[model samples]
Target chain A: MRFTIQRDQLMNSVQDVMKAISSRTTIPILTGMKVEATEYGVKLTGSDSDVTIESFIPVEEDGIVLVENIEPGSIVLQAKYFPDIVKKLPQQTVEIEVDDHFNVNIRSGSAEFHLNGQDAEEYPHLPQIQTNQSFEVPIDLLKDLIRQTVFAVSTSETRPILTGVNMKVESDDLYFIATDSHRLASRKIPMGGNVQPLSFENVVIPGKSLTELNKILDDSQETIEISVTENQILFRTKHLYFLSRLLDGNYPETSRLIPDEVKTTVYIDTKELLQSIDRASLLAKENRNSVVKLTTKENNRVEITSNSPEVGNVVEEVTAESLEGEDLKISFSAKYMMDALKVVDCEKVNIQFTGAMRPFLIRPNENDQILQLILPVRTY
Target chain B: MRFTIQRDQLMNSVQDVMKAISSRTTIPILTGMKVEATEYGVKLTGSDSDVTIESFIPVEEDGIVLVENIEPGSIVLQAKYFPDIVKKLPQQTVEIEVDDHFNVNIRSGSAEFHLNGQDAEEYPHLPQIQTNQSFEVPIDLLKDLIRQTVFAVSTSETRPILTGVNMKVESDDLYFIATDSHRLASRKIPMGGNVQPLSFENVVIPGKSLTELNKILDDSQETIEISVTENQILFRTKHLYFLSRLLDGNYPETSRLIPDEVKTTVYIDTKELLQSIDRASLLAKENRNSVVKLTTKENNRVEITSNSPEVGNVVEEVTAESLEGEDLKISFSAKYMMDALKVVDCEKVNIQFTGAMRPFLIRPNENDQILQLILPVRTY
Candidate 1:
């Protein structure tokens, strides 16, 4: 392969593909990135068994020539140092050439690098997801959906299916749900005539895959097409392609985990409650899980307290906007509460409690699109 | 002890003293910070046996009341959570009260923290360090001197004394030198009229202590007094006091390591040389020390190259402004060269080489206050 491309454009594409490459891959060839140059443009592919990423740099963009002097060929170069070499190249334009024996030569200005390249034929082919079960969504909205529910997934491998986020579509509504047996987070949005009526019961995606995809995606209003098949899913944009494997088992039913009857409800400023819990958890961190207790008081006030036998205790009083129903007391992990509060970008939030041991519900006072639930700890 | 202090003022003083407290200290009391409230101000002290730092917040500064309602007493609180607590206090002013039994209550706004405090008498006493040999130097200049030479200190414990920087004072000049048997860095400055004509030859300060001290001192024009004794050294500012123990042993003779004879000299832009070597070392990093080779060519050009048998090689040619005397080729650690180049903040640098096997010298073309020496490696 022989081609010359702009340094900045090549750097960006290399970085995007590198997100899918893992250094711990057992297969030697999978540790390298495949580069192909054709009449259309240059494409780079990286995969780590579970996820594959491909990025393309066109020959010309917006009437500006980005690549020139192309010779159609393919080669795989070690992904370890390829990105660093491309980023630190000493010129505005870089020329890459591969000989028949797969010896890659990269030249820019007064610097030249010769890297050993592996045979591109040894690379495993990316699974093709050829299905009409696809939908279009704005990139920004997709990123938001991933952030709102992915963190609630189980990090342990005890239940492998619980490590992924479950996506369910019915009629014109789409929902994403994730639960780790202790807490659950669910978000729903309307399809708005863009997608046909479709239903998928068990479409579980690994939480790690979504986290990496979210990081690679830019916050733009541009739309991306997501296509789903039996065992794989593909997210395709203008010049990028992301493919991830689906979990093998069905996700657990999480609807029953959220409590229905609310014995007490309290409305408070989100920022004030977050700060109070943060301070109360300082002494609690001496223990393993860092748990804090919340008790409703008279005159629309709540007390947050945490105690450790070795290191004393802390108490914080936060004034609530309003309170109704029966007074309640609950104790839960401070980390879980803080994680739920961080995603609720609203001035006020309402928390409803059913009992001391049941999972409580927390949602924005003004919106019902997102709901977060946390199971309380038994301190008595 | 009882007092109310400005939150911002207390936070700054706590952070400064916490730098001297180490979490892994063997002594139990050393894990706590000693806080004393006097008629004049409030003082915070933290020590880890090797080094001690104290910060004082005066009752008033520049017409602003930093502290008030002070009842004279002292107590020691666990240093692990003190800084975080002070930073996250919920009010403009914080009140701290310690009962006679050493139970501390810290209140701010609607939040209160009750911490288990130890008696101040149990804390170790800081060394007095009474000596007539004292000198004053500008804080900015002292910080600069530490930065230029500290990185060259030997990290291995084979020669315990080599882990420290040797400081020697003679007549009106002070010199600092450090080496790890391979590379050496030295910086010198003239003591102004504020210091008497006193000389100390055995004052060796640990490199780690100097690094921490440099980070705590701000870049200001005000001078700080440094006093030296048989076993300890004290650095006293207007509102802070830092004490560190001196390393005991004779320092190696480093003057002879820098060769006086020069067979070849080259002048080049510091930035260009640094970037070229950085790129050349990418492949060399596979090995431990990351060594790169430099060879002088015709037409005032230098070639930087590194080769690995498994992974190919890289070569970069940098043009020098002037090359004189004999031609030369030398190999050295890229990290050592980069460390020296980073500290020499000059447009141009001059490198003098005696031979391929002997040591070489590098210094800024504009001044001679700092000098760096590196020993070349044998390629054959």
Candidate 2:
């Protein structure tokens, strides 16, 4: 492969692909990043069995040349060193050439690097999702969907299926839901009439893949196409492609986990409640779950408290905008609550409690699309 | 103890003293920070036995009131939680009160924290360095001296004395030197007859102490007083006191390690040489010591190269301003060279080599106050 590319454009593509490359891959060749120069542009690919990322730079875009002197060929360079070398190259543009023996030469300014590269033919091929069913979602909204639900996925391997986010399309609405048994997060976005007539159920994408994809996707209004097959899902943008393997087995039905009845409901400023819980958590950190208790009082007043016998106790009172139903005291993981509150993206939140021992729900007061449920700890 | 102090001022003092407190200290009380309130201000102290730092906040500085409602008393609070509490408090000012039993209450805005506190009497007293001789140095210059020499200190404890920077005052010049056997760095400052007539020949301050002290001291032209005794050294500024137990041993003589005669010399741009070495080190990282070879060529050209048989090789050519004497090739640790060059605050640097086997010297081309020496590795 022979090509001269802009340093920054290549660096960005390398970083995006690097997110999918793992040094612990059992397949040694998979640890390398494949670089291909075509007549149109340069393409970089990285994979580690579970996830694969590909980024392409065009020869010219908007009349500005990003890559030049392209020769159609391919080589796989060690991902371990290629990224750093490209990042620290001495000029705005770098020239890369590969020999018949797969020897890679990278030159920029007066610095030149000769690296032993693996034959691109030895690398595994990317899975081709040959399906006509695909949907489109704006990049920013897609990133938000991932962020809102991915953190709730199970980090433990006891239940491997719970490690993925359940993505479903029904009734012209797309829903992303994730639950670790202890807490759950769900976000729904109206598909409107823009999405094609396609529906998928029980499509559980590994949460790690969604997290990495969220990091690589810029917050732009540009829409990205999503395609799914029997075992893989692909998120494709104009110059980038992210593919992740779906977890095996069925995802558990989580709709029943969210509480239906509310014995107490309080509307409070999101920032105020988040801050109060954070302070209470400071003293509660000694506990395994970092549990903190919230109690509703008279006159729309609520008190958050946490006690650690070895440390001390903290109490903070926050006034709610309104309160209804019975007064309640409940304890739950402070971290879960903080994470949910952070992604609420609204000024006020409504929290509903069924009882002290059951799961409760927190939702943005202005909308019904985002909901967070947390299983209360039996601290009494 | 009772006081209401400006949150920012109190936070800075807490952070400063926190540097000396370690959670793994053998003495349980040493993990707590001592807080003393007097009519003047509040004093915070933390110690890990070997090093102690005390920071004070006065009732008023300049025309602003920093502390108010002060009652004279003292208590010790867990360093683990106190700093974080002060950081996230909900108001501009924080009210702290301690009961006779050492129960502490902190209140800010509507947030209240009750923390268990230890009796201040159990905390060890600050060491008394009673000395009639003391000298003064500018805070910024002192910080620079520590930065320039501390990185060369031996991280290995095999030679305990080499883990400390050797400090000496002679002939109206203060010098700081450190070495890890393989490399040595020395910096000198002319006292200009303004310092007191006190000289110390064998004072060695622990490298860790200087590093922490450097972090705490702001870059300012204000002078700080330094006092040394048989076992301890004290650095006292207007509101901060840093006391460190001196390392107990004789520092190895390092003056002879620097070559007195030069076989070859090269003058190069400091930044250019540093960047070139950094690039070469990228490929050399697989080697234990990250060795890179440099060879001088005709027309003031120098080549840097590194190779890892299992990986690949890199070659970079950098042009020197001038070269003289014999043609030479030497290999040395790229990390050590980079560290030394970073401290040379000049555009051009003069490097002198004494044959291929002897230690070479690097100094700013314009000054003789700072010098760096590195022992080359034997590579045929």
Candidate 3:
């Protein structure tokens, strides 16, 4: 492979692809990034077993020419050093040439680095799926959905399916749900779409892969096309392609875990409630699992308290904007609540609970589409 | 202590004293901050066995009145949580009242925190030294001297005294020297002293303690007093007193370590040299010691090269502004060169050496008083 490309453009594409490369991959070739020069542009691919990220540098962008070459070929270079050298190159354009034995020469200005590149043939082939099941959604909305639910996925390997985010689409609405058996988060968006009316279920993409893809996607209003096949799913944008393998098993039906009826509800200003929980967690954090107790009084005031035998206790009263139903008390992990509240960017939030011991739900005071459920602690 | 102090003032002093406290101290009490209220003001102290820092919140400063109290007492509180709580408190002036049993009530605005405090008497007292030998130096100069020499101090515990900065005061000059056996840095200041002045020999102070003190001291033109006793050294500013126990044992003779001979000499821009070394280190960092080679060609150019047998090699040339003496080649740790260059705040630096194998010296082209020495590696 031989080509000279703009330093900045190459660096940007390299970094995007690097997000999918894992240093701990057992297959050494998977740790390297594959670079291919085409007639149209230069493409860089970085992949582990679960996710693959491919970024393209167009032949010319705005007036800056990215690549100029007569030969088209491919080679794999170490992702760790490739990005660093490209970033630190002393010139506007970088020249890359690979010899017969895969010895790659990268030259810019007075600096030249020769990195031993691996044979592109040694790289495992990315799965090419032909089953045509595809849909489109706004990149910002996709990122928001991933951020709202991905953290709730279980990281444990015992039940591997729980480590992925479940996506369900029915006619005009798409739902994203993730649960770790301790907490559950679900978000639904009314994105009207149809190539053919689809009701696809049991689609689980690894939470870790989605997070990396989310970071690579620009939060613009640009649309992202997502295609799902029998084994692999692809999320493609204008200049990037992200592919993630599907989880083999069905995701647990989490609708039953969220309470259908509420015995008590309280509306609180999110920032004030977040601060109070933070302070209460200070003392509660002394324990292994930081848990804080919340009690709603008859006068719409909620008292937050946490205690540690060595560090004493902290109590704070935050007056809720509104409260109804039977006055109730509940205890839960402060970290889970804080994480849930942080993702829901709203002025006020309402928390609904069936009882002190059951899984309670927190959502925007006025919007009910985004739901977060947390199991209460048996702190009697 | 029963008093109300401004939140900002208390937070600043707490942060300053906390610098001296370490969470891993074997003596648990050293992790606590001692707070004492006197008729004049409140004093906060934190100490490890090696260094102690006491900050005084005066009764009044300029337009800000900090303390209001008639009763006097003292107590010790855990350094970890107190700073966080004080920073997060909701009011301008915080009221702190200590009960007979040392339970403390800290109230600010509508927020109240009750912390279990330890008896101040149990906290170790600051060292009392009859420091008749005292001199004053500018705070900016002291901070400058500390920064220039501290980075070269030995971190290994094999030779305890090499971990300290050696200070020697002659009739008109004060010198600071530090070395880790591989590299040495020395800085000198010409501060005129008394005619019947006390000639002081080399006294070593732990580099770690000086680093903490340097972080706390502001680079103002204010004069700070330095008083050295047999086993302790005190740096007293207007509202702060820094006490550090002298490292026991005789500091090695570092004067002989600095070579006066000359051979190959080169002048280079300090910033350019630093950036080049940073880039060179990236290639060498895969090796155990990260050694980079430098060779001055007869054609007035410097060649920088580093190679790993398995990872290939890199060679780059930089044109020297000026070069003299026999054409030379040397290899040294990139980290040592980077450290030495960081302390030399000059536009251009002149490097002098006896031969390729001997210890080389680097000094500012504008000022030769401050010198840095780096030991070369034997590259096979």
Candidate 4:
């Protein structure tokens, strides 16, 4: 492969693909990034058998020449050093060429690097999904959807299926749901009339894949096309393609886990409650579960408190905008509540409590599309 | 003890003293910060036996009231949680009161914290250095002196004496020197004639202590008083007192390590040489010492190169402003060269090389206050 390309553009593409490459991969060739130069542009691919990322740079874009002197060829270079080398190249323009002996030469300004490259033929072929059905979602909205539900996924591998986020399309609304048996987060959005009326169930993408995808996808109004096959899913933009293998198994039904009856309801400023919980967690963190208690008081006031026997205790009172039904006191993981509150993205939040020992719900006061449920700890 | 203090000011004091407190200390009382409130001000002290730092917040300073409603008493609070608690307090003003049962109560706005406190009488008394002889140096200059030499100290405790920076006064000039036996760094500054003429020969301060002090001391033109006793050195400012114990051993003489004769001389842009060495080290880092070779070529051009047999090789040519004497090729640790070059504080640096095997000198092209020496590694 021989090509002269813009250094910044190449660096960005290398970084994007690097997210998919893991040094711990059992397959040796999968640890390397495949670089290909063709008449159209240069493409870089990285994969660890679980997720594969490919980024392409065109020779010319918007009447500006981004690449020149392209020769059609392919080689795989060590993913360990290629990204750092490209990032620290001296000049704005970089030239990369491969010799017959599989020696890769990278030159920029007065600096030159010669790296041992492996034949690209050794790289495993990327899974190609031959599917006609695809859905489009705006990049920013997709990122938001991932952020809102991904954190609630089970980090423990005891239940492997729970480690992925379940994506389902029912009626005209698409739902993303994640639960770790302790907390549940779900977000829903209309698929819009432009998208084809398609339905998919049991399509679970690993939470880690969505997290990495969220990091690489820039927030833009442009729509990205997503296609799903039996075992793999692909997210594609104009010059980028991200593929992640679907987890094999059935995701548990989480709809029943969310409580329907509310014995107490409270409306409070989201920021105020978040800060209070954070302060309480400072002491609570010394304990195993980092549990903090919130008790509704008279005159629309709520008190948050946590105590660590060996360290100390803290209590903070926050005034609620309004309160109804039976007064309640409940204890739950402060981290879970903080995580749920941070993604609310609104000033006021409505919290519904079934009882002191049951799961509760927190959601935006005005929006019903996003719902967060946390199982309360039995402190009594 | 009871006092209402400004949260920001109190937080800063807590953070400064916390650096001296460590949980690994054998003395349990040392893990807590001693808080003493006198009629004049509130003082916070933390110590790890080797080093002690005390920060005072006066009731009034510069016509501003920093503390009010003070009652004379003292208590020791856990350093681990006190700092974080004060940092996240709800209000700008925090009121702290200690009861007879040694329970500490902290209140701010609607937040209240009850912490377990110990009697301050158990805290060790700070060393009383009764020395009449004291010297003063501008805080910024002291910080610079520490930065230039401390990095060269030996991190391995095999030779405990080499882990400290040696401070000496000779011929009306004060010098700071440190070396790990492979490389040496020395910085000198003149003691103004207005100050008393005094000298100390073996005052070696621990590198860790100096690093912590440097972080606590802000850059300012104001001079800070320094007093050295038989085993302790005290650095005092208007509201801060930093005390560090001297290392208990004879520091080996390092003057002979720097070559006095120069067989080759090269002057190069400091930034350019630093960057070239950094890039070459990328591949060299795979090896143990991260060694890179520098070879002088014709026309005042120098080549920096490194090769990892299994990975790759990189070569960068840097243009030097001038070259004189014999042509030379020398191999040295890129990390040491980078560390030495970063502190030069000059646009161009003059390097003096005796030969391929001997040590070399790097210093500012025109100034003489600072000098750095690095021993070359044998590659061939």
Candidate with top lDDT is 2
**What ranges in model 2 sit over 4 Å off?**
none
Candidate 2 lDDT over B106-189, as tens digits, reads 999999999999999999877788886798899999998999999999999899999999998767788999999999999999
Q: What lDDT tens digits, residue by residue, belong to model 4 across residues B183-252?
A: 9999999997623544455589999999999999999999999988778899999999999999987888
Query: Regarding DockQ, does 1 or 3 come out ahead?
Result: 1
DockQ of 3: 0.60
Q: Write the per-residue lDDT of candidate 1 for residues B10-74, one digit (tens) a residue.
A: 99889889989998999999999999999999999999999999999999999999999999999
Which residue pairs does candidate 2 place in steric collision? none
lDDT per residue (tens digit) for residues B46-117 in model 3: 998788899999888896688996378998988878898888776788988889998987887656677888
- Per-prediction DockQ comes to 0.88, 0.93, 0.60, 0.84
| Predicted candidate 1 versus true structure: per-residue lDDT over A295-366, tens digit per residue | 999999999999887888999999999988887888999989988988877899999999888889999888
**DockQ of candidate 1 (2 decimals):** 0.88
Q: Find the number of clashing residue pairs for candidate 3.
A: 0
Better of 2 and 3 by lDDT: 2
Task: State in Å the error of residue B313, model 1.
Answer: 0.7
Model 4, span A179-222: residue lDDT tens? 99999999999876644554455589999999999999999999
For model 4, report the TM-score of its A chain: 0.98
lDDT, candidate 4, equals 0.92
Model 2 score (lDDT)? 0.93
TM-score attained by model 3: 0.96
In candidate 1, position A64 carries an lDDT of 88
lDDT of each: 0.90, 0.93, 0.85, 0.92
